[model samples]
Target: MTRVRVGCVHLLIAVSTVWVTQAQMGFVFPPVRIQAFSPRGIRVSVPDVEGITALLFDGNINKRIMYDKGDIHGFVTTKTNDYWVLDDPTVELHSGDVINYNVLLETGRFENSPILNGHFKSQQRHVVFNLERRSPPDSSLTVAESKNIKCNQSVTVVFNNNTPICSGQIIFEEDFGTLKEDVWQIEQYIPTEDPAYPFVSYQRSAVSVANMALHIAAKLQQTEPGFTSSSLYTFTLDLTDGCTGKMCKKQPSGADILPPVISGRITSKNFAFKYGTVIVRAKMPKGDWLYPEILLQPLIRNYGDTNYASGIINIASARGNEYLVANSKDYGRHVLYAGPIMDLKCREQLLQNKILVNKSWADNFHEYSLRWTPQYLTFSVDKEDWIHIEPGARGLVSRFPDNCTDLPRERLASSSELAPFDDLFHISLGLAVGGSTEFKDDLTTKADWPKPWRNSARKAMLNFWKDIDAWYPTWKQPELLIDYIKVIAL
Candidate 1:
């Protein structure tokens, strides 16, 4: 739990901010700003600080003071232990100026803090305080004179109909301590035998928020009142109340049956961003045919031909299979994949680089970062840039000339090389089970004890349910665990 506070002492102009994680003590955050002191001196009282004993600052080029153990060693006025006034005229701050400042908060426990500097010994200082600054805007212009004023110094980020913000500002953050419906909309529909994710039925019970994180677990379809995972018992699923898309009602046919597995998928309905850095810290799930996706989908798909025309950025993607030898290679948790998809035909061109890690990505939480800009898109794991894409002159379409032929030509409508992708995109997170298109039904993909389901067969779901004993035992804690998802302005 982090709580940051910014104090105001008569027109304190601060544009920069420093963040420090007090993993040890979690003391009340940080350097209490007390600038904007007049030459006559202003009494700045820092409240809410009970344990703080010493306060230090560079009074001027010739003077430095430290209030420690009730001993005032400065030229300023110290009425009480927590009360300080800058009576020194030489250290007065002006309206339009910049300065480097730090607040040493010695809580007695900062051995390896990121903000701690080497200048102070561990015994003397426990925390470091660095302040942010930028020249204040000119106040000479009146409301009549300021018309259509455009800010050029701030970073360009569009969201919530707000103006530009300072660089490195956290525009969006979800710690997943509690899953809020206002931020994420659950996908509740039975896409039985659909092209992309035709196997699983997304239900609310499969997902949960707990233990300071979002847990999206996959559950077996229980043979209940009206629905059954088996084909022998004919049943139907009528999800009319909370269905997200069409096909709310489905039943067992000659071959096509109800979804054998129940999983979860959530889309960010309230947030969308154009170009910025996205960081998703999550642990991949482990199970057969489990597809975990961290993606950025366009808010409005207005460029390409069909469904995936505008663009979709796959920040990070991986299968949950523990080990599966596909074409003499293991495309399991040990491998990591990242890339993009557009126009629905670029599966070969969809993936940029499939990285191989020392162990499984499902073993622990790893940071998946996407640095998106107008000119390029960079993907990184743990701050290590693994793959980056510099859009061609014809945009991403040029990368798939022969495959995605139906659309790419429409990219000429825009001047941006990253056309389609240049638009606003929303964050998406979820876990899908038993998809036909993602995992092929052939030896080339993975025989894995003769994959219970066949992609081409109409009774794919029914066939998979028949051999539940073979794969169901492998389903152990098969859920997507997300630490947090953060977005920073470029």
Candidate 2:
């Protein structure tokens, strides 16, 4: 009985081994055969076609392998002929454009329908589709409009994306290839989430070619996948003499009209109406003392030569100036803090009634919105309600008393009238330096000097040397860096 049981077990093991061998050597899935250009008539209207290589992979394969070569390459585009390859068998046709295979195996004849065994390309694998081809999207885009303008003209460009393209930035060049254009003033941004205009303007302020190039270059790239090549983004550009609506014909002596809008660079500038409230959304640099300003030029000539340059008002509490509301002379003014609870109605005769800086003036990108209707002036940073100045409310006064005339609370309130703010002019952005001529001594405290004022004084000294030396660096090179500047007209 023992011999009989042992013999039965041995027989079962032999049968199992035979079955496994047969499975491995038997039915094998065939390599997919791509029927050349369907005779039944399927047409692909690819404009440029040259070295196009087509690839396919199995859904279950550890990695999608290409037959052309054995490396990962982005999707294929052709300048002349479309390239094709037979990869996996039984591919799932998606939109007749992409194919995903479920089974991949060597070709062989079986009793009936070919099947893939448990065998795979490798024993252990990370299932990422690996491609092999030439390079990616060539650094060239179709030009929808190219005209030399003598006067400012509203230029419109409509792009047709037929294939998936890498998210790229725009650049402006002159003479078609002499690095960047001489003078191209423009602004642009992706109209993806918020409705804001991305403004790109040439910096007459920059002295270095490298620094100016950095400011002029707009770099953008796609970090997401699966975006089809046919998604088109449009741009509407208007060109005018810088600061003036008047247009010039042919690239002006100092200003040129035909500037390249390359990928990853700021687009040309677009101005809003003078009375229109300006919303500046910026990506702020670091530090607690940096009060970023969005410099803007007035649509109309500023109130003539009155040291009062026209711009929206910005409230800064830390850099020596605290914009506060006057409740009483006996009582100290209210100090505005971070968050939405802090709101002050400020209307400074010396400053415009607008939120001049974004909420992100110190840290991350923040949205700074200023509402300037005929009746009320509201300022918000990062969507947090900060302050509002009503038409009949007390105007913004200097934080510190200076040579400027001072007014008593009750008497001044009755006599003060809100100045009619009409146009916006050159948009300037800089930090408030303590010793700079722009600073008002009225807000400085001899007591606060040892702490906050001391810090400002130090920063001011450093800034002075930096600005002077920046023009002609001896050892260290200066860089022109601006993450982004946006303006909205509503």
Candidate 3:
């Protein structure tokens, strides 16, 4: 009788010994077999099993064998009484090699057993196992490299084989390459008084494009035999030179003073858009009394018209005085100004002013963008941080000050119907010097101007202009670096 016993270590423990008899020679006892058995003196086919096992007894079977050169390498076995060697005929094996094999005893269960080593000599038993390696995670890959990425815009990437790895699009872009004459005109007009900085004088010579960037520089120029920093202009008309009628009078000697600092300004006079996204990537100059501005101006400069209320959008402004008063440490140097400036009553209600309190405007290049639509306008820095303003939101009205009022009842309350902004507006980029009284003392009344807060603002501005030479570095580069300007229809 042959007996076999198999049990899990965690379940049961039983022992059974098998006795074999040779009938022809009388009774013959055989020792219990736990190891594999192979037929003696039998030459097996290449990659064919040479060994077989009847019953597995104690622990799981783990076998490691060394072989000489052979084509038969891997192995497979069924516990019912058969074992088969497996191999790929295409792969050749070398001699004197070590191979490890782990075999599970149960059909569906495997044992966590350590590997055991053994020595085997066979030239035909050596084989190789074919396995494919997996790729690493996507997070391990670097960012895509692309050359078409414009300033403030996204870009896509393609592989060397012309297969696209990633994708991006640029709607509108201007590199200021050699100044597209049809799209841009150098502003030649000098304002009698600038709305933001009244003391600034604009000059036409301050604007230029070189090295693929728009350069607007503020330099110390000789104006009226004195050295001063003034802004450049796009349009300048001598009011006294063109008039010949009785209504014309001789202009004052200092009435049309040349701007002390000559800087550059360019305007898209012929090209204007109603609603779109505008992006300007630029680096600001460093110094006191300097102002770099990116703005949108209405085609018609009238206050009474419907477009006037929404006409002006101050996308980016870096005023030295504002930076000094706000103290770049407390408030950031970037400022956004939006609202209806034509009427004081409407201005209070619609004014959407905010200071970006995080980054330094003059330290490095930054992408300043404005997303303008008929419903609302959004200002953003690097397209990450944003501020949204809806023109007709009554919640924006101010309730302070007994005499203050909201937008007029008869006026169109929504941004789409507002004048100035409703019409097409040309873009303007300029750098000016000095401070404007428009923002002075928070534009408060005389009584409020005497407060300590107002006093500190005055002192800051006074100190800036008093030690102008100390604050303004004459040798340093005095130009704003504009990498590109882009506009995309919303």
lDDT of each: 0.60, 0.27, 0.43
Q: Is candidate 1 or candidate 2 better by lDDT?
A: 1
lDDT of 2 by residue, 1-490 (tens): 0010111121011223333443444421121222212112111112222222322122222233322222211221222222222222222222234221221222222346322122222111121223322222222222321111111211111122122221111111111111223122433322111111111222223211331123222211111132221111222233233322232122212211121111222222222232334444444322212222344334443333222322334432222122212232110012222211101122233342223443323333355555544445566766766766654334333231434432233333343343324334333333222232223323322233211222224243333323322211211111223432323222
Models 1 onward score TM values of 0.67, 0.31, 0.49
* lDDT (Cα, 0-100) at 38 in candidate 1: 43
Q: What ranking emerges by lDDT with the best candidate at the front?
A: 1, 3, 2
Output the lDDT of residue 349, model 2.
35
Q: Model 3: per-residue lDDT, tens digit, 1-490?
A: 1221223222111111111111222211111111111211111111112222221222111222222111222222332112221223232222322222212122212146322111111111112223222132111111221122212312221111122111122233566545765457765544433434333345556778886588988765444233423311222324244322222222223223334355667777345656677888888766555667687877665434342333467776664432443222222245444433443433334445556566556767888888776656678777764567654333222222334442333343332343335566778888776544334343321222211223234343333334445545532556778887877644
**Residue 65 shift from truth in candidate 3, angstroms:** 67
Greater lDDT among 1 and 3 belongs to: 1
Worst 10 residues of 3 by lDDT: 12-21
lDDT of 1 by residue, 1-490 (tens): 2111213211111212212222123232322334343432222223224444443333221122222211111322232323433222233344543322323333332456422221111111111123223232221222432221212233435545343353554556667645777668887888643346556788877778886578888887664455444543476776777887677677767666677777887888667878889999999988877878788987876674354666788898788777766567677778788887765555547575565667888888999999998878899999899888877766766766765664556654455787778888899887877656567665232344767677667667777777688777777758998888878767
How much lDDT does candidate 1 score? 0.60
